[model samples]
Structure formats: structure tokens, C-alpha cells
Target: AQSVAQPEDQVNVAEGNPLTVKCTYSVSGNPYLFWYVQYPNRGLQFLLKYITGDNLVKGSYGFEAEFNKSQTSFHLKKPSALVSDSALYFCAVRDGDWGSSNTGKLIFGQGTTLQVKP
Candidate 1:
């Protein structure tokens, strides 16, 4: 089975400091990794993905992630945190072939709520 773990329930940071939200995944075969952000009463917004390439992948809102195959991890990072950046973060994974309508079910982690204090 495929799964993702977001070890942190919440992350608190002050505006202007670097921030990071950790994530790890497990899958039967090669996985399609994704990161998403959700605001209050809103749907998940795609952040970035690691299809296949350099270990580091960049995404929206100045966010980046490192894909470590050996460790089975893809941690999201940003150079600076903002109050507006405070929101719920989610790490998700799907099977390599999961994109097809037949298997487009995306399994998401519990989520990590970030509080960026001004």
C-alpha cells in the first residue's frame, strides 16, 4: 500500500524566518509525490511534484522540496515564512500509474497546520 506521514501536527514560525514541513512516503512501486496546501474551508491547492529529475524540486510560493529515494522522504522548505503563508500543509502520494482515471485516487497525509506569527 502507498502512504504518507507528516510527523508534525503543527509548525509555528515567525514571519521572515525559514520554514519547513517534513513528509515521508511509502509505496509498492515508484511513487508520484505531491505537496498541497489548504486554507480554511477550501480545497487543496497543488504546490509541487517530483516526477523524475534532480533531487530538488521547486514549486509555487517560493517553496521547494528534496526527494530522497533512499530515505523515502520529500521535505518542503522555504527561505522565509510569512503570516499569509500560514495554512494547512499536506503531503500526498499516488502509485506511478495512479494518474489514470482508473486509479487517480490520491492518498493524503493527515496535514500540518502552520502558524506564522507576525
Candidate 2:
């Protein structure tokens, strides 16, 4: 089984400062990691993904993440935080190696609320 953990319930950052939302995962085999953002009364929007290749993956809205296989971590980072960036961030993962019975479902972490204040 694969699972994602978002240790922080909320992350507070001032505008113009860098922000980070921590995420870690556990899986039986290689992992397909992804990040999504959700606004009030809105569905989750795709941010980035790490299928393979580069250790660092960039995504929408000036967001990026570093894939650290050694630590089983895929932490989301932004060089500068903005008030508009404040939203619920989610980290999701799925096992790369799936069996016939596997549904290829993604397990998401408890969402982390990013509060960017000016």
C-alpha cells in the first residue's frame, strides 16, 4: 500500500518569502508523486508530478518540488510566496508497480493549509 503524510496542518509565510510544504510517502515500489492545490469551493488542481528523470520538477504558478528518493520525500517549494498562493496543498502518491487487481488509485495526504500574508 502507498500513503502520503503531510506533517504540518498549516504553514504560515509572509509575502515575498519562500515557502515550503513538507510531504513524505511510503510505497511498496517506486512511487508516482504529485502535488495539487485547492481553493475554496473548488476541486483540486494539478500542480506538478514526478514520473521519472529529473530530481527537481517544476509546475504551475511558479511552484516546484524536489524528489528525494533516499528520504522518501517530495517537498513542494516556491521561491517567493504570494497572498494568492494561500490555499490547501495536497501531496499524493501511487505505487509505480501495480498488479492486475490494483486500481491505480492515488492516496493523498492530509491537506496542508498555506497561509501567505502580506
Best-fitting candidate, scored by TM-score: 2
lDDT of 1 at 22: 96
The number of clashing residue pairs in each candidate reads: 0, 0
- Candidate 2 per-residue C-alpha lDDT over 10-112 given as tens digits, one digit per residue, 9 for 90 to 100: 9999999999999999999989999999999999999999989999999999999999999999999999999999999999999988778878699999999
Error of 1 at 82 (Å): 0.8
Error of 2 at 84 (Å): 0.1
Per-residue CA lDDT of model 1 for 1-118, tens digit only, reads 8899999999999999999899999988887899999999999999999988888999999999999999999999999999999999999998785444646678899999999999
Q: Tell me how far the alpha carbon of residue 12 in candidate 2 is from the true structure, in angstroms, after superposition.
A: 0.2
* Window of ten residues with lowest summed lDDT in model 2: 96-105
Scanning candidate 1 in windows of ten residues, the lowest lDDT window is 97-106
lDDT of 1 at 16: 97
lDDT of 2 at 5: 100
